[model samples]
Target: MKTLTLAATAILLTAGFASAQTVRIGTEGAYPPYNMINDAGEVDGYERELGDELCKRAELDCTWVKNDWDSIIPNLVSGNYDAIMAGMAINEERQKVIQFTQNYVPPQASAYAAMSADADVEGGVVAAQTGTIQASHVAETGATLVEFATPDETLAAVRNGEADAVFADKEYLVPHVEESNGELVWIGEDIALDEGIGVGLRQSDTELKDKFDAAIASMKEDGSLNEMIGKWFGEGAPLFE
Candidate 1:
């Protein structure tokens, strides 16, 4: 819904840093284990905790901004925020418009959820959040894709039989399926979408990006990053090693 250019992005980043301003990090507060609005109506989740640590390590003054997922990248490009840490996987398509720091979270699986175990996610009507890798994957496959503005809407479509299944990140869908008490179940094996999750920044903010990248690299080297990933995603969660 929003668009951005490299020149505009660079100018914004340069001006903000000149005065030692707070670097605003953008996230979709609706995706859990990554980002969500807590009971206090503030951003919380793995990204929140990880972002705070990353900022602390980089010694940068930073803040968080919640934005709609579809507009997250456009807003970042348009200078609504200085970075993105909303469980975004690093991929070639996204790399074309914006730059990314090294990945923080390892590549995770995507899966399908439905009321029936045999639901045809491969060919039947499937729902996915708009502007996500799942939506793009569904569109490219034989399944008829139904796009929703949010993840909850996609699950609701499946629960109500409006869709055969909902395709999304396995991490996000895991709790929902477990809570369904047999009402919903995984329909297929895991689907791998991108390389890993990373911080999204404007191409011009090379200096800022380097700071976060170095922090992320340090965490990886010390195993603190994997510990954080396991803590949030469960002990069985994937690790760099």
Candidate 2:
């Protein structure tokens, strides 16, 4: 919500980037591969690396700020941060509130994990993080949707038998399944949801959005964006053409 003064606007127009002030980039520090608090207590992961590169390319003085996923948008709208790079999907519902840079991550499937491969994915109780596309989808599907405040809680619901399955981003669920030692398995076919993940910006901050959009485009064209995606999501993840 920071507005540039006329002199600052002139400088920004000449610079061709949102450089009038430090752009605060908000992210959920709990989502791994997308973003997480590392051993050093600093934000780390794919979005962190991508955000740094975008800032470098855009010539924007930027800083990373951690926010809970459920309130991330509201805080941004309230000017708690200037942009969001928290693996948020670009969809019609979100478009009504905020602007988005072109997707840095491509459309990917969501998967259901449960204790048994035969677990009922349709009619059984399923857990999903609150305010997520997966949560809304599970509510719409035949499954009895159980909501949790955090991604870990959704998985815990499956682990503790509170829910039959936990539905989430396939990449987000892979590490848990692999490390589950046979306790968790993919229960059903993957479900595609949302358009893709992008950097969310305030609707009024079109200049900031344009700066990030151009930086994302440059990375996409140079293949560095795909490289970072693979580094985090694994080589099997889909990449842009």
Candidate 3:
């Protein structure tokens, strides 16, 4: 009798564990359109909106956490966050350490400089976002790379003539350039570095990954994803037509 009761209790405990779901989403709140803080002191932007929708669709309790860009991956691996929603691109290197959900949006990259020739990068000094693909790309070119933690700092480096130009994603850079009072320019073409972006999870959490995949698919089907994109980039937003 005792053995049977113990087996039943174990089964119930396992069931309860299976049903438990709480996901922590991480983002670098410094990047606008993806994640950023407005004057209201609240985090607002594309990734935040999309993450809320994902949690609702998946029926999971969710919390948002702001993480520095360079530390996001490490925190996720340490189980500090269940997923990363910071417009993170899934690449071969990242896949080794984490699993990614389905792609959420079209891929886009951009390169730009100030309009004035004086702002032109000489001697190939370019500013790139630290820990991003753009930084890797510029480094490969053997350019004297000046790394910045935020988009604003990267643009500021170029605007102030501290660096030649900056390369990054179009989604965040376009609006910044226009709003910078002619301090920046959109270069001829965006550099294609990789495919679309997705949510990052620890390698052991395959069940959570499956949930995220289904939620993202539903979001795409119901046009919620499109709505969020338009909200951030506008109807005529480059890259999402």
Candidate 4:
């Protein structure tokens, strides 16, 4: 039975190896300024735009797949995808589960204070996404955390007073506030998460990981990365700076 099991594992491994060249990218098509699904059901946003740019630089044929935000990292680890490009912030906790490319995009955090006292959020109070830097700080500061799946929900939570404040990437939330009818302020202070956004891969796939790093370096040197960032994020954005 052990012999049989080993043989089956070998066959599966061989198949995985054979098809590894074409990198599969996973994302949540609902996180705007990172990844979002358009009305046409196509993924678009800064991360999506960056993914295409990386593929071009690496000369790799890439295929992008959209999944829920909560499932992206799990799917990548399960081999459902070769990498993750969901505007994910690379922190030490996540590093235990997967490897990440060099910081392609610097990390930026934004905080939004509530404009009302009657807003309704889960648990009727808190700030920032759970497990995020803001949440950690709130926890330490003895404040409650009202977690949400998307920035829209987070911002809405603040507007309605369900949350005392909301925190996330400025690039993601600033545009949202600008377009909203509410009066959310930047607070002029950001919580630096000490993380950078990067492509995620299996911890053992050094070769593939190196390719992504090389591609990113090339893109930066050739100004393609800057151009892509400017195109997606606009000039003088804090995330880009």
Most lDDT-accurate candidate: 2
Model 2 misplaced stretches (Cα beyond 4 Å) = 1-15, 18-20
lDDT of 3 by residue, 13-100 (tens): 2332235367889988998788888798777888888888777766677898989998999999998988999978767778887889
The collision pairs in model 3 are none
Q: How far is candidate 4 from the true structure (C-alpha RMSD, Å)?
A: 9.3
lDDT of 2 by residue, 131-154 (tens): 899999999989999999889999
Worst 10-residue lDDT window for candidate 4 reads 1-10
In terms of TM-score, how similar is model 2 to the real structure? 0.92
Which has the better TM-score: candidate 2, or candidate 4? 2
Q: Rank the candidates by TM-score, best first.
A: 2, 1, 3, 4
The positional error of residue 95 in candidate 1, measured at the CA in angstroms, is 0.9
Question: lDDT by residue for model 1 over 1-241, one digit each (tens)?
Answer: 1222434433433442334347899999999988999999999999999989877766678899999999999999999999998888888999999999888888889999899988998789999999888899999999999999999999999988889999999989988988888999888689899988999999999988867776677677667888888888886788987
lDDT of 1: 0.86
Model 2 lDDT, residue 125, Cα:
97
Error at 52, model 4, angstroms: 1.5
At residue 27, candidate 4 shows an lDDT of: 88
TM-scores for the candidates: 0.90, 0.92, 0.85, 0.81
Comparison by TM-score, 1 against 3, better one: 1
What's model 3's overall lDDT? Answer: 0.75
